[model samples]
Target: MPKLSVVMISMNEEKAVGSVIDSIQEVVPDAEILIVDSSTDKTAEIATEKGAKVIRQYPPCGYGRAMELALKSASGDVIVTMDCDATYPSKDIPKLVLLIDQGYDLVNTTRVLTKPKYMPLGNFIGNRVFALCTRIRHGIKTTDVHSGMRAYKRTLIHALKWNPDGPALPVELLIKSVRHGYKFIEIPIDYYERIGNTTLNKLSSTVWTFKRIFCKEYFD
Candidate 1:
């Protein structure tokens, strides 16, 4: 079986970091857990003690920079990215990896499949609108453009270019990779309430997502 790497980005997610790592271990015991943390708390320490590699991105790096570091630093053939806040299902780790083994290049999880109760109403609507825009404009047929849980084949990472700077990286990567003809799949997953307050700046993230939807990378 291909080696698995579970990667996450954290910023003051201490409360949920340990539980998330434990859950991943239960599902994929041998998979390596790598975290790129920009926390001012115990998030990195807890993750390191739980056997995850902790790469510090202190002074509160933005979401895109942190995620980019985590993804690039992973050493597994199959890399699974998830939020450290325990909102995504750990049980789905193996399922995503299974898809990767079956020849898919990228796997995304859909949290809005049944109206996630934990997702705020504004976010829910915003996600749908952005997803629709991606489908119509870019032919990227994802129902949740910002879903944090995803699996990626490592080669796909090298096969594309990434310019991650802020929270809009997901949509940017999705648009470019799918346009580049990489095989993509999405599976339904449960979303739970988060373990800490959200650090997202909704207005800025929303604007960024829209900007990336038309980012020339999709064409060039």
Candidate 2:
């Protein structure tokens, strides 16, 4: 079996991090768990107790930087990235791995199968608009451009040169993957309300995403 590494970036997600790790372990027992935590709470301690290799990401960092740190430290053949707030279901991991096994270069899990009431109306609209813009601009058809849950071969990381230092990382990844001609797949996955305060600044994030999209900096 190919080694699987589950990586998460956490920020003060003490309440949900442990449960997230446990759920992933239940689904992929032998999978390696890695956490890049910049939490000021007990998130790091809890993750360590749950058997996840915890790497402390210092302050003054963004989600992309944390993700990059975890990606660099991951040792598995396949790397699965998910949220630490329990909004993403680890049970869907097998589906992603299966796609990777079938030779897909990158697999994204979409929550568009069913709209959850907990999701903000602004987020729903923004995501759809961004997805449409991505398709029109780059010829990449993704239903959920901001979906956090995704799986990909570790080697795919080397084929892309662009890396954003903020929340725009996911969009950058998808854009670069398309530009590089990597096979991409999106599957619907279960989504839930997050357990803690969301750190996302919807306005700023959306603006940054559009800026990057228009500037075509993702090609850099």
lDDT tens per residue, model 2, 145-166: 7888999788997556766565
Model 1, residue 92: C-alpha shift (Å): 0.7
lDDT of each: 0.89, 0.85
Query: Once superposed on the true structure, which residue ranges of model 1 sit more than 4 Å away at CA?
Result: 217-219
The worst-scoring run of ten residues by lDDT in candidate 2 lies at 211-220
- TM-scores of the candidates in the order shown: 0.97, 0.96
